[model samples]
Target: MSGVLEKIGQTQDKWFVFLDKLESRMHEICTAAVPEIREVFEQDRDPYKRAHGHLLMGLRGQINQMRSKANEVREEKIFQFIDGITSELPGHGFFTGSHDRLYTFRIACINRHNLFEEKIAFYMSLLNNAAGEQDLEAAYQEQLQAFEAIRDQFSCKQCAGQMTIPDLFFIATYVTCPFCQTQNTFIPSTGAQMVLHQARSLAEQRTAHLLKTYEESKPKNSLLYRQYLRSMFDEWNKIVPDMAEENEKFYQRLLQDHLNSINHY
Candidate 1:
């Protein structure tokens, strides 16, 4: 290859060095941020979780700064490297005869951008790991068990009749008194209400194996994906029956969109 083309290749090679430096710096930031976020989360006392929110926002801000800097480097350096390759015009490489300079530039840009994205994900995962180490899961479970033990303690307000709150309810639900035939409002604790928000996540975890199979299937089988979605939604609806209609509509729309995309092709 000509000296100019070789220089362009070497410039492309330097992208690895740039990425290595960026990743090393991201590691340092995450090393400091992760433990700090975990400490704040562990010390969290407010029901509003303002401290946790602030800490998370601070970590996200650092991530955003890193992303922005990486983007600037890609725009200034990676593109400059590709432009060097493009500068040699129609004779720089074997594929030069095809006049695919734009495609070449696109491929190089995508490669570097993908590298940056992977690093961004790695840094973000560190924050997520820190949060996951919290005792919230144990708290949620303990609160749930306590509610279960005292579920029989509630009664009908109207007739002073026995009321059985047969299931674990996240929100205030109407419990029918067996003897008086009156509906009584049963309110759960704040921690129990958190289960309402966690329903979808719990359902997803239960059906993750099916979802994984659907995701790993080649040719992107809509049937497999739909099966996984149906199972997941079934579990979600079981957890929150009030949202079944809304969730079913969402499921149908997604299925329709998937089918439509296949047809449109």
Candidate 2:
């Protein structure tokens, strides 16, 4: 058993070395792209063309090339590494009788795969943004201020009556004018629209402890998960009080879906 474990450890170390070299190469190429992207941002005065159009074409092209190179490395090198450890070595199998060793080997492979996948995602996100960094909170606050400024400044389509929106809503909803009593459908900004979903994620964060408790349990408890889901929905409803009626229906649907997925979970 000790001999088998030693061999497996050596194989895992070799795989890690291959990953390190690949990652180093990937970083080198991506770093070379940074200056060109910065130059594009500085030179392009048309904001739309800078962000989503022609100015980004070169960077995107380079990113695709790097992605292709990484994929090729993953296929040729990663599989070869696995094959070296498991199949190509000898006729005498190391894990034929040892289930524990087999499990560990599979787990190690999965961890390495997951690490590469995350690294790829990070590179993609870094490449996509013009500034290479985003101030999400600042953007959200700016959007909120814009919404607040225009919230009360809408005219009734039916009577041309000035009406103040009573509440901030992300999605389209009927707003009744006080003077004309005409229900005008108010459409919110795209940023305001996403806030409707962001509130739910915030609620999940508030109930993260309950979720952790359920997830960390051995021989997983369905009741604990249900409790966590209920608590999360409660928090969600509290955050969006006006959406409580709609949220309740969603909560029921989510619960039923989760129940149906218990076996899979």
Which candidate ranks first by TM-score, i.e. highest? 1
Tell me the spans in candidate 2 whose CA falls farther than 4 Å from its real position: 1-20, 23-150, 155-162, 260-265
TM-score of each: 0.64, 0.49
Best by lDDT: 1
Residue 176 in candidate 2, Cα distance off native in Å? 2.3
lDDT of 1 by residue, 1-265 (tens): 4565555556566766777787788888788887788778778886556898888888778778878987887788777656665665665445652235346545776787797898788778777777663344465568678887888887789888766688778878888889888878888878778777877777787788998998898987778888988998998897668788998998899778878888887
* Candidate 2 structure lDDT: 0.70
The sequence of per-residue lDDT tens digits that candidate 2 reaches over residues 1-265 is: 5665676677667666766776676677667766666666655555233443464566557556655765665566555555655553345644353446645775786688578767766766666664443233454567678878997788999899888887768778999988888888998887777667667776777788999999999988889999999998898777567888999999899899988988675
> For model 2, how big is the CA root-mean-square deviation?
9.1
Clash pairs detected, candidate 1: none
Per-structure clash totals for the candidates: 0, 0
lDDT of each: 0.75, 0.70
- Residue 214 in model 1: lDDT: 80
